[model samples]
Target chain A: MKSLLSVQSHVAHGYVGGRAATFPLQYLGWDVDNINTVNFSNHTGYGHFQGSAIPEPELIKLFQGLNQIGCSYDVVVLGYIPSAELIDVVASEVAALKKSNPSTRYVCDTVMGDQGHLYVNNSCVDAYRKLLSTKIADVITPNQFELELLYGKPIDSEKLLRDAIAYMHDTYGVDHVVISSLDASVLNLQELQLICCAVSSRFKERSQEQSQLQVFLVPEIKSYFTGVGDLFTALLADKLFTNNGNLVLAVNQVLTIMSNVLKLTHQLGIKEFTQHYGEDSCERLAEGRMNDGESMRFFELRIIQAREFYDYSGAGEFSAIEISN
Target chain B: MHRNLLSILSHVCHGYVGNRACVFPLQCCGWDVDTVHTTNYLNHPGHGTFQGEKNDGRTISTIIEGLKKLFDLREYYNVVLVGYCPSAEVMTAVYEELEPIYKTKDRKEGPVFVVDPVLGDNGRLYVPEEVVQVHIDFLKRGLVDLTTPNQFEMELLTDTKFLSWNDVKSACYKFYDTYKVPDFVILSVLIDEQMYSVGFSASTETVFYVPIQEIRCRFSGCGDIFTALLTNEFYSNGRVLSPQVLTLVVDKLHRILLTSFREERARLGRDPDVIHDINLVRLRDLFERSFGGDLEVKYL
Candidate 1:
C-alpha cells in the first residue's frame, strides 16, 4: 500500500482540509497520516467558526515525532497552512523527506483563497513563492487566483494562462501543473461553464515545439460548496500516482468524480433546504444568500455519500480538449 | 443516510491506534467522523521508541466548544466515542464539555456515548492513577450510555476480581446498577485457551459471550478498532446490543487480525509475536464485507 502524509486544516463538524482529503485517499487504498494545521468547529465559510490555527511549535513537534518513528511516505500533500511560518516549516519538512527518499512525490494545493479573496496571511504568498522556487513540489493544483499569485502577474487571457503554465514548468521544474478552476471571463466562455486546465512536463519534454494542455469543461452548480478544492487535490494526487503520472487521464478521472460529487451535494442540499424552509428556499440557496448557521449545514459536501464515485473510471463525461500553444 | 460520529481519542502519526485506527474503518462503514485528538504520538509506544506530546486539556475543551458553536451535538452526531485520553486533565475536559449534550439527549432517540476506558491491559496501569479516577467519576455520573472495557479495566472499574464467568456476570450487574450505564462489553476475556468478549444488555436483561479467534501475534490497535466497529454495529441495530451484532463485529475483527498476522509474518519471514501497526488499508474490504454464521454465543 502507498503511504501519504496529509498536512491540512481540520474541522470537527464538516468536511474540509484533512477531513475532506483523508477518507477518499484511504478508500482508494492509501495509508494516510494526517497533520491537522488547525482544529476548527467548521469551515470558515460558515462566517462564524471557532478554533485556532495549531501553533508552529506544535506542528514542528508532530513532524519530529514522525521522523523519530522512522516514518517515510510515498507522497506528501500540503493544504491550508494558516501562516507563512507554518508554510516554511512544511517546506523544510517536505524538503527533508524528498532529500531522504529522493522519490517522494509532493502534491501542493496553494490554498490562499479563491475568487480574489485572501483568507490566509498575505505573507503566505511570499512563503509559497520561496517554496516553489526550490522545485520540491512534484505536482501543484492551484486555482486561477493562486496561479496568478504564484506567477507574479495577472492571467486575464487564455494566452497569459498558457504562458503562466509554461513559466511554472520551466522555472520550478514542476512535473505537473493543474489549474483547478479558471475564471470564465479569461476564456470568454459561457457563464455557467467552468474550465480546468492541466499540463504535464513529460508531455512538454516529449515534444519540443509547444506543450500540450488539456482543458476540461465543468458545469457550475448553483449552490455554494466548501472543501471542493481540497477534495479535488486529494483525488488528483491518488489518481496521478495510480495512473503512473498520466496527467490527462488522472485529471479526467478526478473531474468526473468531482462533477458527480457536486451534483449529489447540490441535490441533497436542495432537498435539505426545502425540508427546513419549504420549496421557496431553493431560490435563496441558489442565490448564495444563506444567512443562518442552520442553512450552512446543508451546504457541506456529500463526501461520505459520494464514496462510490472516488474509484469511478468510466468514460469521462468531461473529456479533455487538447490545446497546443 | 450517513450517520455522524464524534470520536475523541489519541492520534498517532505513523501507526493505527486511537483515532488512527478508528477513523478510517468507521468512515469506510459510512460514518462521518469528527475527531478531537487527545495526544499526537509518532507511533504507539509498543514500538519502544515514541515521540510527541499530549494535547492540553484546554485545547480539548476549546475544540469541543468550537464544535458546539456550529452544531447541536445531540442532533448532529449519532454516536460520541471517547478513547485513550493520556491525562486526567484531558479526560475531565472531555467530560465537562460533553456532559451537557448527554444530559439533554433522550437515550432511546439517538446519540449514544460509547467510552472505551483504556487504562491498561493485563494487570497493569499504563496511565496515571488520576486518569483512572477521572474515568471512574465519568462512569459513576452515568454520563456514558455504553462502555467497552478490557478485563483489567473492568476489574478496576468495579473493584472485582474475575475468577470465572460468575464473577464476570456479577461485575457486569454491579457496573450497571452502580453507574447507571445500560450496556457494557468486556473485551478479550481468555479462559482455557479460548478468547471471548462478554457483554451485558440492560434492555434484554441478559449476559452473553461471543467467542473470538485468538491470533498468536499481539497487535496494538485491536481494542480501538473493536470499539469503533462495535459503535457502528450498535448504532445500526437501533442503538441496542444483541448476540447477532456482537457476533458480526467479533467475526469481522477476527478476520482483520488474522490477515494482519499472516501479512506481517510473510513480510518479516518469521513469526511476528507482536505486530505494531495492522494493515487496515490492505484489509479495507474486510470492514465492508457482511459476515454470516454467527459464532456460538453462550449465556452466562
Candidate 2:
C-alpha cells in the first residue's frame, strides 16, 4: 500500500483541510498520516469558530516522533499552514524527508487564500516562496491568487500567467504544477466555465525541449463550498502518482470527481435548507443574506456521500486542451 | 439522513487507532463524526518507541465547550463515543462536559453514550491507576448508555475474579444492576480456545454470544475498530443490542483481521506473533459493503 504524510488544518466539526483530504486519499488506497496544523471546531468561513493553532514546538515534537519511529512515506502532501513559522517547520521537515529518501514525492498546495483574499498570515507568502526555492516539492496545486503570490506579481494577462508557470518550473524545480482553479475573469472566460490548468516538466528529463501544458474547462457550480481545494490537491496527488506522472489524466480525473462532489453538496444543501426554512430561504441564501452560521452550513462538502466517485475510472466529462508555449 | 457522532479518542499520525480507526469507517457508513482528541501520538505504542503528548483536561474542556457553544449537542449528535483517554484528568473532563447533556434528558431523547473503557488487555493495565478510578466513577454516575470492555476491564469494573462463564454473567448482572448502564458488551472472552463477544442488554433481558474467528496474529487497533463498527451497527439497528448487530460487527472485523493477517504473512512470512497494523485503507471495499456473515449467534 502507498503511504502519505498529510500536513494540514483539522476541523473537528467539518470537512476542510486534513478532514477533507485524508478520507479521499485513503479510499484511493493510500495510508495517510495526518499532522493537524490547527484543531478548530469548524472551518473559519463559519465566521465564528473555536480552537487553537498548534504551536511550532508541538509541530516539531510530532515530526520528531515520526523520525524516531523511522516513519517515511511514498508521498508528503502539505496544505493550509496558518503561519510562516509553521510553514518553515513543514519545509524543513519535508526537506529532511526528501533528503533521507530521495524518492519521496512532495505535493505542496499553496493555501494562502482565494479570490483576492488572504486568510493566513502575510509572511506565509514569503515563507512559501523560500520553501519553493529549495526545489523540494514534486507537485504544487495552487489557485490563481497563490500562483501570482509565488510569482511576486499580478498575473492579469495570459502572457504573465505563462511566465509565472515557467518561472515556477525553472526556478523552483517543481516537476508538476497544477493551477487547481483559475478565476474566470483572469482568462476572460464565461462566468459559468471554471478553468483548471496542469503543466508538466517531467517530460524535460526525456530530452524534450518544451514542457507540456493542459487546460480544462469545466462547468461551475454556483453554490459556495469549502474544502474543494484540499480535496482536489489530495486526489491530484494520488492520481499523479498512480498514473505515473500523467498530469492531464490526473487533473481530468480530479476535476470530474470534484464536479460530482460539489453538485451533490449543492443538492443536499438545498434540500436541507428547504426542509429547515422552507423553499424561500434558498433565494435568501443565493442573495448572500443568510447569517454566517446558516451560510456555512450550505457550503459543507458532501464528502461522505460522494465516496463512490473517489476512484472514478470512467471517462471524464471534461477533456484537457493542450497548449504549447 | 446521516446521523452525527461525537467521538472522543486518541489521534495518531501513523497508524489506525482511536479516532483514526473510528472516524473513516463511521463516516463511510454515513455518519458525520466530530472528534475531540485526548492524545496525539506518532503511532501506536505497540511498536515499542512512540512520540507524542497527552492532552490535558483543559484542552478537552475547551474543545467540548467550543462544540457546545456552536451547536446544540442534543440535536446535533446522535451518539457520543469515548475511547482511549490518556490521563484521568482528560477522562474527568469528558465526563464533566457530557454529564450535563445526560442530566437534561434521558437516553431516548438525548445522544446515546458509548464508552470503550480502554484501560488494558491480557490481564494488565496500560494506563494509570487513576484512569481506572475515573472510569468507575463515570460509570457509577449512570452517565453511559453502553460500554464495550474486554474481559480484563470487565474484571476490573466489577471487582470480580472470573473462573467460569457463570461468573462473567454475574458480573454483567452486577454491572447492569449497580451502574444502571442499559447495555454492555464484553469484547472478547476466551473460553476453550475459542473467542466470543458476549453482549447483554438490561432493557431486553437478552444475552447472546457472537463467536469471533481466531486469527493467528495480534493487532493493535482491533478493539478500537470493533467498538466503532459496533457503534455504527447499534445505531442502524434502532439502538438495540441484539445478536444480529454483534454478528455483523464480528464478521466485518474478522474479514479485516484475516486480510491483515494474510497480508502480513505474505510480506513477513509466517510470523504468527507479530502485531500488525490492519490496513483499513486497503479494506475500504470491505467497509463500504453491506455487512453480511453466516456466523451463528449462540444464546446464553
Candidate 3:
C-alpha cells in the first residue's frame, strides 16, 4: 500500500491542517504517518481556542524516531508550520528523506495567509522562499496571495500571473505548481468568478522544455470557508500520486471535490441562518453579516457529511482548459 | 440526522490500535468522530521500542473543557466512547470532565457513555494497577452506561477468578447486580476448548453468549474494535444489548479478524500462526466491501 507523511497543525475540536488532511487520505487508502506541529483546542477560526505548538526539539525527536523505524513514504504533505524555526527543521528533514529516496513526492502547500492577510510571522515568508529555492517539493499548491508573495511582486493582471508562473518554474525548478484559488474579478470576468490554475511541463527526454497551464474558471461560492485549502492540497496530492503526476487531472479532480464540498457548506450555512433568522435573512447572511460564532456550525466544510463524494468517479462536473499565451 | 461520536483513546502513528482502530470503522458506518488522544506514540508498544509521549491528564481536561465551550454538550454528541486510558490520572481526569454529561439528566437526553474497560487481557495487566482500580471505581459509581470487558477485567471487577464458564457467567451477573451497570459484555473467554463472548443487560437481567471461532491471530486492538462495533450496533439498534446485537457484533468481528489473519499470512508467505500483527489497512479494505449494507449474522 502507498503511504504519506502528513505534517501540519492539529485541532482537537474541528478539522484543519492535519485533521483536515489525514482522513481523506486514509479513506483513499493511504497509510498516513501524521505529526502535528501544533495541538490546539480547535482551529483558530473559532475565535477562541486553547493549546500549544509542539516545540522544535520535540518535533525533531519524533521525526528521528520515525527514521529509525526505517519506513519510507511515497509522499509527504506539509501544511501550516507555526514557526519559521519549524519550517527550517521540516526543510532539512524533507531534504534528507528525498535524498534517500528520490522518487518520494513532496507536496507543499505554502499556507501563510489568506485574502491579503498574513497569519504567521513575517519571517515565515522568507523561510518558505528559502525552502522553495531548494526545489525539494515535487508539487506546490499556493493561492493567489501566496503566489504573489512568492513571486516577490503583486500579480494585478493576467500578464503578471503568467509571468509569475513561468518565473516560479524556471527559478524554483518545481515540477508542478497549482494555484488553487485566484479571484476572477481581477480578469474582469462576467459573474463573480474563481480561476484555478495548474502549470506542468511536458519534459522532452528529462529536460524542461515545454510547459502548459490549464485554467479552470468557476463561479465562486459566496461564503468564506476554513480548511478548504488544506482539503484541496490533500485531494490534489492523492490525485497526483494516483494519476502518475498528471497535473491537469489532479487539479480537475480536486476542484470537482471542492465544488461539491463548498456548495454543501454554503447550503448548510444558509439553512442554519434561515432557521435562526427566518428565511428573509438569507440575503443578509449572504451579505456577510454572519459572525464566526453564528456560522461556526455551518462554515465547517461538510467533509464528513459529504464523505461519499471523496470517492467521486473521475472529476465530476468540473473541467479545465489549456491557456494559450 | 447524523450521529456524532467523541473518542478518547491512544493514538499510534504507525498501526491502528485504540482510537486508531475504532475511528475509521465508526466513520465508515456514518458517524462523525471527534478524537482526543490520551497518548501519542510512533507505533503500538507491542512493536517494542516506540517514541512519543503521554498526554497529561491536564491536556485531556483542557480539550474536554474546550469541547464544552464550543458545543452544547447535551445536543452535540450522540455517543461518548472511552478506551485505553493509559494512566489512572488521565482516566480520572477524563471521567471527571465527562461526569456531568454522563450524569446530567436534563435537556432532552444525554449522550451514552460506552466504556471499554481496557485494563489488560490474557491474565496480564498492561497499565498500572491504579488505572484498573480507577475503572472499577468508575463502574461501581454507575458512571458507564455500557461496558465491554474481557474475562480478566470482569474477574478483577467482581473480585473472582474464572475457573469455568459458569464461574465467568456468575461474575458477570454479580458485576451487574452490584453496580447495576445498564449493559455489559464479557469478551474473549475460552470455555471447554470453545471461545465465547458473554453479554448481560441490567434492563433484561439475562445473559447471552456468542461463540467465536478461535483464529490463531492474536492481534492487538481486537477489544477496541469489538467495543466500537458494539457501540455502533447497539446505538443504531435502539440501545439494546440483546443476543441479536451480540451475534451481529461477533459476526462482523469474526469476518474482519479472519480476513486480516488470512491476509497477513498470505503477505508474509507463511502460516497464520506465525503472523503477529493484523494489517489494519487490509482490514479496512475488507470492511468497506460491505460498507453500506446491513451486516449479516448467520450464526443466529
Estimate, for each residue in B1-300, the C-alpha lDDT of model 3 and write its tens digit.
668889999987667788778887887777878888898777777767778888889988988888787877767889889998889999999999888776755422678878998888888998999998888778787767789888888888898987786787688778987776788887777778878888887667777676788887677777888888889988987777777788778878888888887777777788655333455555666555433323332211
lDDT over C-alpha atoms for residue A287 of model 3: 72
Error of 2 at B181 (Å): 1.0
Q: What is the TM-score of each candidate against the true structure?
A: 0.96, 0.96, 0.94
Per residue, candidate 2 scores C-alpha lDDT tens digits across B1-300 of: 868899999998888889999988887787888888988777888888877778788888888887786677987789999999998989999899998888866668889899999999998999999999999888988878789999999989999866777887788888887787888889888877788889998767867788888877778888888999999888888788888888888888888888888888888776657554778888877887876767888766
lDDT of 2 by residue, A1-325 (tens): 7999999998878889999999888878899999999888788766778778888888998887787788889999999999999999988977777887888889999999887899888999999999999998888988888998999898876678778888888888888888877765655555565655545555325434666666788776453678889998999888888888877877888888988998888888788878888878878877876437766665588888888889986566788777655
Task: Give the per-residue lDDT digits (tens) of candidate 3, residues A1-325.
Answer: 8889999887776768987888788888888888888877787776787777777877887777777777689999999998899999998888888888788888999999977988999899999998988888777889889998899998877778788887777777778888877777544454544564545553323545757776788667553678889998999889888888888877777788888888887777677657866888778766776546656755777667777778665854667766766
Q: Candidate 1, which CAPRI tier? A: medium
DockQ of predictions, in order shown: 0.73, 0.72, 0.56
Model 1, position A101, has a per-residue lDDT of: 79
Can you list the residue pairs that collide in candidate 2? none
lDDT of 3 at B189: 74
In CAPRI terms, model 2 is classed as medium
